[model samples]
Target: MMLDRSITNTLWQLQDANSRQVLALVQKFELPEIVARILVTRGINVENASDFLYPLIKSLLPDPFSLLDMDKAVDRIILAITNNEKIAIFGDYDVDGATSAALIHRYLKEIGINSTIYIPDRIDEGYGLNTAALLKLKKQEVGLCISVDCGTIAYQPIDDAKSFGLDIIVVDHHISMESLPNAVAVINPNRFDENFPYNNLAAVGVSFLLIVAFNKILREKGFFISKKEPNLFDLLDLVALGTVCDVMQITGLNRALVSQGLKVMSARKNVGLRILFDNLRILEKPSVAHLGFSIGPCINAGGRVGEASLGARLLSTCNEEEAYQIALKLINFNNARKVLENEALSEALLQVEQSVTLNTKFIMVSGNWHQGIIGIIASRLKEQSHLPTIVISLNNGIGKASCRSVPGIDIGAAVLSAKFMDLIIEGGGHSMAAGFSIKDHKIRDLHDFFAERFADFVKEKMIKVDGIITVKSVNLSLWNQLRRLEPFGVGHPEPRFIIQGVRIINPEIIGTNHIKCLITDGNTTARAIAFRSVNTKLSSAIMQSGVKTILGRISVNYWNGREFVQFVIEDLMT
Candidate 1:
């Protein structure tokens, strides 16, 4: 039977789980009923439940050489290290790219090699390898250039680097075409010719594998016989930061990487990361949420509004003073980015309110927006409207756009298709996100193309509930039991449960948009918060004085020295 829609204009569906399987999970693993149900719904059976709940790197880490051209890339990097060649790392301008570059650079530095880290300007250089940047590196006498987090599709630039007497190795994780770029080595799991078991790694994850292979070969060749080898484990903090920030699926190897990486982050081993944490006033133990929301955005702020290379420099630096200065600068840049983001988001929301209609299938808004901030604007709009959104920033007659897509939609493929049809000047991305350039005159055509492409897509938003519970059941014990499913992201999501027959008490606005209130079942009350719900129907329903059912994830909120269970509201039933 179909359930009625919630106040958010979407149906709330309870996830289905087999009763027999749930019982087996509970009996075999000694798990709680709700946790077992969650595991069952995620297709976790007795055979794989152990591995899923307790993912270890030793068990999940694949042979680094399993990726195609891994040996070739390792050999080239070893040659560069042995011959004392000047190496330059060209990376993208996001958190993933910065961490990839920093990871490789730190590994190289530990091996007594100093390499230049180059992050292309988002506005000036756009993304990936450019001919001018390669020529500039060549002029600086850089013999080997490793392009991290990008360069999978830079056919012309890689070829140009070859002609210019600079050998380039591409360490990336973006989807590849049937034909490959002419780099010295193209090490990517997603290569069509490759048979890598796990291909959904972020670019930083790919870079880590490259270093692993490189380290293995060096050890076999007795290169580290006298000198101490770099401890690769120390680098997991960067891996975790990149993996979470890139929004990679936290399963299998990624789950292990982040699980271990959080431990490393807590130790404050990385000087830059430690200073960043201190400057940001993050006193609590680090979690995936802290990495993705707090640290990642600050690192990304440099690429968006300030110097593109600041994040890489901060991550790679060892000098305490340098790290401190860079951390402060990134924080300031992030603050500035927030101001710009708020302004752009406000403008975009106004456009949506004025122009968007119920028939609108795709939302595309263009303005004199900051080029670096459009991606964030698109993300905010997508969350609000539940539609694939494209936010474009206009400069002269050219338009630079960033796209964010909903589930079941392939925005990247759509952008690529648009590019193939000459609707865009240049574009490519993964399924959920993409970017492209187009002429201002073709804006209407691009909109029409996306509209037609997504015409059959359902516009209604849905929230899947794990199970139903009462307000009395919201407690620390339940939250701790749910902690077994930690490090949630794309594949493994934080569980959302429905709390029935709740009434709001002491509802007040907190922060800018969040509502802080106490939800009660007339007997027991629990603290609840609805984040970014202001001005929405959800907020309206949350403030009303009536019996209501709410869906939210349970979490622990610490204030001062007291810890209390907090319900994070997602949707409300009225």
Candidate 2:
């Protein structure tokens, strides 16, 4: 039976079946009904629930050879490893790119291969493989160049590298074109001609597969008989960080990778990561939230506003002092990025509010905003309006735009179409997000094109609530039980529940813009906080209501070494 409820006037959607099988799961698995309902909603059954709760990397891992061109890619790398060729790693300047490059570089270093890392400047060189950089690598005597988190669509640059007598290998997971690059090998599950099962894997995830295949071949060759083998488990920390930072769905192999990676992170083998955790005062074992919000932001700060290579360097460094210095630098960079992001976001919001084309289904804003901060601002605008948002920052006679889309919308495809039609200079991205560049004169055309594309798109706003329960039933044990479904991200979102018939008392403002209140059922009182809800409709409604239905998550909160359960309110229906 589906429990119907509404919060903030948005319909509550439960993305799973409501049937007797939920009770059957509760009885068979000895689970709380709420937990069983969540599992049932996700289609977790008796056969896979055990594996789902305790996913093992070894079991979840697919054969490396399952990906297309895996053999050729491994053969080329093995040749480089044996011949001692100078290899160069060309990576994008984001967290996924940095971690992907670092994962390969670190793996190579372990197997006695030294490789140089190159990241293109976001502003000057733009994204993906560049001819100038490839030529520079060729002149430097680098025999092979490998592109990570990029190069799936870089046709001309790979051709240029081949002409320069430099062989290229592409290990990426981006959306690929029909014709593969002219590189030595292109190992991407998303390639048009390929049908790899794990297309959702992040770039770092793909890089990890290369390392696995390389290690297997080397072990078969008895290379490790003469020397101690590098423990690949230690590298899970990097894989976990990259996977979460890229915002991939935490399911299947990704869940196993991040689950084990979190354990590796707790070991603190990566000096740079440890230093970052320490400086950030993260005393507890890091969670998915810490990785996404705290550590990932710091690592990405370098690529966003500082040196593009700094992030990879920080992640790859082994020196403790150097790690500390880089960590501090990243902290400062993150601070600077926050300031720029705030300014750009404010401007973008104003532009959207005052736009003449405000009647369009998608929000489009263009201004003299900071180029680096437009992506984050576009995401914020999308959340605020529940519509696709495009934020363009004009520089000189050209404009660069970043787009974020809601569900049931394909902003990236629209941008790609615009690019193909000559309405934009260049753009390609996945369904949820994308970026592109256009001439200043084409801004109006781009807006009109997107408006037309989204004209038939119906906007929706819904909150998903997993279950309805009494606040008194929440406890630390229950929180710990729910955590079995750990490393939650895009696909496996953290569960939210509804606690109905709670009286709101002593509503007060807390740090920044959060609302703190005491929610009571007249038997037990539980604390609840609505983050960033100040001066909003949610806050105004909460202030005026005496008794309300609280829609949120139940979590065990540790305050001053005391542990207790509290309601983490998401929304309220009065």
Candidate 3:
């Protein structure tokens, strides 16, 4: 029983002309042919296939005046909101910088244009354009500054806010660094010339298409109201919870911006996102995995454990009892960011189980960890050891990092190889995520510069297995036709199914360290479980196997209650 079903060259397969054009458009939209072969192996081709097989609110969105410098970023923020000046907006405290800085500070105060936002405090000024808070918004003479979900890597605070004159713009979506940050207008769709046809938006859907191109340039300059187009779909539930808590990739116009931003977050209509969806009791209909593991970790737990301007003042508060006391102080700062992300992910998993010869293939641990929660413990060890990590946080000597990658590893090119070996005074991010700054003995030169950059970027790269399905296509009508592919974040995922043979019946050891088997051999009967599979000796050697055997599984279950499946027995033979 030396199980290792092999699959993991950073898992990613499926492209036989995008899986037979996603099984002939899920048999021409009759769907459920295993959710049309996982939505044509997640490319959703065939002319955008009925918008991911039917994610309506009218498809083919785009026209926030067709993107490219979004009409010069909405004609220079409506000429700094009709010259009364002082605008601001900044943002970035997670959940797509607190819903794109609370939807451009409530659409510049619903056109009366007062706007003032800011945000930046991921543990007091981290993540994005700082210059001592742009020199206190250029000593509050601000004038213009837009940003939202971060300025495409500021480039020295947009060159010190244009040498303290101001008029920046930015509205980002991340990937883009060839040198484009003297910001005067940069609404990114990962801008590289911005064809704007769509390349995965969600910095609150590019700041709600720069507030629908600044309300169509304040409706052809009639200035504010003639009363008509201002319903930016009621701020698309804060741009679908910051595009599914900044993971984006739900697909094209971010799946119509998180399916109409989860129906304007289930009609709770602002009031501090309905008191943060009533303190996460979640008064129903929010999904995209509850806007990424529950309201994007309670709005990134006030920028990782309190006061990153309390999730941009509970997403620009107005009332409802001061958004229920900042939604109970952002749910007690997300229970203190889950006890500071599980005490630095249980001491970085006990220093990755007592440093097994510094497990190479890219990993750069550090100690005293908490650079505002070591990027959620390098995203739970790049989702449990898929690889490319980086979780620093020294003290007296500085350090401070936070990475997390796996899919074909590129944690911002392994922290830009410690900023090309200058010992990283600041690195960047992209492929899978990044962030840096260093010098506490630059941890073995950032663990030998990510082991010579994952010996040519993540070993040889191959094990991604997006295939293997059957087991009567895990029914419930293929989970309600994979719920019409309703909102599956970061490049549309959900659809795995692996099941091969079956035979467990009476396994046991339920919760408090799970097991719960129940599969049957007679053609296939289900009910499997694994979650920490009862302290592993391969769960009592597959419950003391006597005869029957053959296994592999992946279509997991338990939507909100949490009984995951996608059969993770990985591999076993008897």
Candidate 4:
């Protein structure tokens, strides 16, 4: 159900000549002129068009040693490996942290170091490193503790680990604070003064650097017995999953990670991945869509609704039976998550409609929402209302909130304001997404804080569209044209098209509440379906309009082996 869309509606007209210009520049280097224009409009030009369009291995990859702490991080890890010292990995329960933990653990084991893996339980303990877990590692007399995906934010936790007489090496990719933590090596690209080539690497990418450095150290120590230092590109499969699931921008290194990662995933080396593909009925050749919607969610489900360790174990294990068991458990958890997400989203939407006069650019919803699924719910609400949203789950006297943002709104900035004024107990994230905690009674203060800050920022902002297109461009060729922009996300989003004045025929229902129709914009005909818009004004227009229909920012789709375009229906003018 893809469409003939442009990156910007006004930048370039959808035509074959422009597409051929784009095609001649890249591997898909021979697409329609409209595609070339869309690609160009999405910030791809003649010089870098080939790179963006193809995402080649050489072009996307950066030098492994480009990071500042690469040598230090590698030397220390290699020393630990040589001494046969016991190493424990401390990781968060989220997908990024879990996957990074698993990736590092797998690489270590492959190099014959059976490191002890420790993932903090979300239900029992909170996000970052807990003192109790460190004490347990102390009891085990572990020599080194490698912190993955987290710990950059934990000023006290790192200090505590050191006080407990433990050696710590932090390998994370989260935004950092001004003061650094006390550790043997802190390998984070976001560290202040870091001129690292790419700040967009996920935690897994950071872990990959440690692996690269360790290999370098090993080779320097006369242990060089590798074919091109063991292609780390293969690990992109894990990298892609974590990057996408964690909701990082798809530009620079992050884009390369997913682009190459998708290729490895389609090959399906990991047994647990094989089961996931088999059960989900995903084809051998997976796509960005498959990774984003299919694989990422199932892995995230374990952390959100079940055990975060489940995803890590699944990715790390070689035991087929264990992998299968974990996959089944994750799938079941994902199923349960869907129902919970539906209920929470529905309630949030209803509340938005009821409060039509809320004078704020951001919406904050607090209730007894499930803490694990709050982030996804926040994302849904953000999309549903086109406003920054924070969904908090209150338990006892404490509340945990997950935030999702919209264009022109900095949710992170909003959360930071609440934190600064002592409204929220703790808060952290980027401009677009964030997480926070507040005392039960402080919810109102936090809301007012966010509302005020958002209002101030709103005056200087506007809706930032990714790219635009139209319905007439829908064709078999455009499907492949969209493929040129593989691994679409945060920064490089999928192409969105605006199709208006299209006639609808025999509007039959599909999905739980969807529609199947023939959408004809006179010269071009595309099979269009609308999801969850069955009874909305969009559906009503298709039903009642005597002439034609208007469409806006619609996503291309394919269902039951048939291609089509679908509209989100921004508005209708008849």
Candidate 5:
């Protein structure tokens, strides 16, 4: 039996279960028991084992019409396409929003429609649709407007758009409130009244579904009888980028979408993405990590500190010359974002250290930090402290704050509640992350409320280990087994395994705060790395210990067409 672990000292427990079902699955599917165990852990039974491992788009993709108001959304787009009406696409500043808008814009352009793209400024306009923006679209005579990755909560602005005789379609995946905005059609799986099976789709995934519905309608009307129909599968590259960047759960439909999308991305079909890949000098095929860490951050930098329109423009533009120029600009923007993030992060860390007596379960740091870097600072601090963190940049009398949270906490719901209660001027976000603006006077009250809400759950910190394996088993075969479960994030996380009684050799500090070491279990030796742990207990334990156990994930490194297995250490026990 397992008991709840203490908050101070981390507990390491083996993840074991009855093996009858796993063994049965291994025999039936002719798979290794190690792979079967992982599949079972993710709730994959005999009926869906193979499908889960190798998900196909045709098998996993749901009917687009199942989502509420999907038909209505498709009808409006068809009307615009047939009548040659001017349409505008409004997207958020993040990667999900940029890719969502790009997916639709590209499809429309393929069918001889030219749509205007709008991305709201993060600092000036904040998130979602504003009344002023809608009025400006009306001035431009845009008959229809589609808001992606945002506008689900902008009731007033959607109402204003209606008054201006502009039809609006909302293709978003954020969790909706009791009532939705007055848009012409809102196609969201997470809506209060909807019953769609897949609710954790990123905004770009929802946007892709809208296009699927749009294409089906056009085909029925013989819109593609003369011209070759656009292959919708080609758009998966954007969908995969948006889904991974937004940190959507990779399961069911999402798994198929991303698996297929990565193939499309590796083909270098998108000129802008190809330029980014070439700039990075990545020789291997694109993986989930490449999208999440490398490509996503660079694309998001365009929205964070550089021009807000750069990301959407880069993704949608078909002109090779324009794509190359925008890609280089985005790379420069990413470098700038890093500098600003480090400066603000140092200040935020100091603030955290000074507030030891605060009675809150969350970390709240307020400073003269750059607004563009606060969100990244919040995310880094949250990871370091294993607690929900909010970084606020004070400008004039009001504070703009970005929040990041751990599992089991709904920071976005808390921020939204504060907004509803008038404690915050404005704010909205998802469960794991959020943003808000608050007056200086209400800071104390916000702290008190957070303490009361989160204190009871603060003691639940335990590091979960999937299974223990011999170091000798960490070879090419094990790597292949792990690769079967691709595209891990959020809900379906990457599995971490434990290797027992390993001896470390030649441990040394590497880049920044990372430590690199060679480990051996008497039979096999492998390279392992621990990130951002230069001076931590793991560093000392690895160097001084006689024998130790380490927790990590396995990855394959390819160089000059040769492949080898590598261990990425996440935690250690002496």
Candidate 6:
């Protein structure tokens, strides 16, 4: 049975899991009933249950040559390494790009090759390979240049580079067009002509495969006999960081990479990551959450407000002192970014309340906002309004827009369509997010275009409850069983359960927007926190007295050298 729409405007319904299948899983795997139920709901059968629970890199890693043009990319990179040609890595300014650039740089450094890492400034160079930047790299005598996390559709700049006698290799994961760039190799899984099994890989994942293939070729050629071979496993930490930050689907090969990378991260082998963790007082072992929330933001802050190349430099640097200094800068930049983001979000929220109508399928707000923080603002607005949101920063008659979308709506494809229709300048992204540029005069046209395009869009807000449990069930054993589904993100979300017959006790505002309180189900009481619910209907319902029901994910909160199970409240029923 589905419950009525909750205070958060979402219908709560228990997910369908076959009881017999759940029981079979519990019997065969000796798993907790709750764990088995979750596995069954997620489409895990007895045959693939073991692999789902324990994703190993060696077993899950795909053949490198499976990707189209991987052989060409590997061969070109190997030729540069053998000839000792000067190489330059042009990467995007975001965390994925930074991690991808660093992974390649570290691998090259291990093989006694020093390559220059170039991350375009967000303000100066918009995105991808610019003709000027390519010319600059060419003037620097960089014989081989590799672009990561971007350059899938950089036809002009790539053509320009090719004309100037610069050999370019595009190692990216963005959706590609019909015609390929004029590069040595465009090794992307999402190529229209490619038939790679798994295509949801982050750019860093593609870069890792390139190196894996390159290393294998080197070993076969006896190049590694004279020098110690670089352990590619040591680079999984970067891959994990990029994968989580990019919000890629954590399944199949990605699951294995992240599951193993988290282990490598715990070892603190990367000097820069080690120092950053020390500075942040991250004493506990790193998890997917830590990478996404704590480390990813700091790394991305450099591209947002500080130096664009700081993240790559920090991840690739070998000096401890330099790492410490860069980590401090990143932390400070992140703090500054938060302030700017909050300010912009407040402004955007006000605009939404004042101007948005129920008929509006999506929210588009333009202002003199910081281009760096508009993406965050778009995400915040999307979360609050539950619609596709576009936050644009206007500068000199041009608007730079960052879009975040809800489920069932492909904002990236819409943006690309708008680009094709000449409503915007240039834009491309995945399903859930995208970015584009539009002339100020054409903002209205773009809005009308999106409105007509999404005229049939209807957001049916529904919250899937994994299971129903009492407050008494929130304990260490259940939490431990849930840990088996670690590293959840994007496609594989953390399970949320409905806790019925509960009372809210001592609801108080914590930090800025978080509601901290205690929940009691008659005999047992537990701590619960609702994040970013201030002045909202959910917070209002949570503050009221008497019996209540909440839908939330169970998590362990560590404080004062102790761990406590906490209910991270997501929604509440009246």
Query: Per-residue lDDT tens digits of candidate 1, residues 1-574?
Result: 2357888788887889999999999999999999999999889999999888888888888999988888888888888877888999999999999999999999988988899999999999998899999999999999999999888878999999999899999998876766889999998887769889888788999999889988998899998999999989899999999999988889889999998888889999999999999898888889999898899999999999999999999999999999999999999999999999999999998888898888888889999988889989998999888999999999999999999999889887798789779999877777788889999999999988998999999887877778989898889999999998887887898998898888999999989999999999989998999999999999999888899988989988877867899999989887
Error of 1 at 19 (Å): 2.7
Badly placed stretches (over 4 Å) of model 2 are: 1-9, 14-20, 356-359, 556-564
Q: Give the clashing residue pairs of candidate 6, or none.
A: none
Total backbone collisions for each predicted model: 0, 0, 10, 17, 0, 0
Candidate 5 stretches greater than 4 Å from native: 1-8, 356-360, 558-563
Report the candidate with higher lDDT, 3 versus 4.
4
Question: On residues 1-574, what C-alpha lDDT tens digit does candidate 4 reach at each position?
Answer: 2233221121222222244455655445565565566666566777776677667767766677777667766777777777877899888777788778888887777666798778877667777777788889988988789999877767677788889888888887766666678888888887876888777777888887678667667778777565335566777788888888777888876887788888888788877788888788775477766777888789888878898689888888889999989989999999999999888877877777776454557777777878888888888777655678888888999999989887677676667666767888877776677887789998877767766677754422222332344565565556666666677888876655545566777788876777777767667666666666765766676677465434444455654676555554443335
How many residue pairs in model 1 have overlapping backbones?
0
Tens-place lDDT digits, model 3, residues 184-215:
88877766677776656667777877777677
Model 2 Cα lDDT, one tens digit per residue, 145-226: 8899988778888898999899999998877656788989999888888878888888999999999998999999999999
Residues 1-574, candidate 5: write the lDDT tens digits. Answer: 2323322256666566558879878889888888788777778888888777788998888999999999899888888877888999999999999999999999988887899999999878888899999899999999999999988788999999999898899988876777899998999887889999998899999999998988898899998899889999999999999999987778888988998999999888888888888786677889998999889998899889999999999889888889889889999999999889878877888888888543447898898877778888998888777789888889888899999898888887888777777888878777888888899888888888877778876644566667888888778888877777777876677777889889998888877788888889987899877777766666777778588777888887776788788788877766
Q: What TM-score would you give candidate 4 relative to the actual structure?
A: 0.88
lDDT of each: 0.90, 0.85, 0.69, 0.73, 0.85, 0.90
Q: TM-score for each prediction?
A: 0.97, 0.95, 0.34, 0.88, 0.95, 0.98
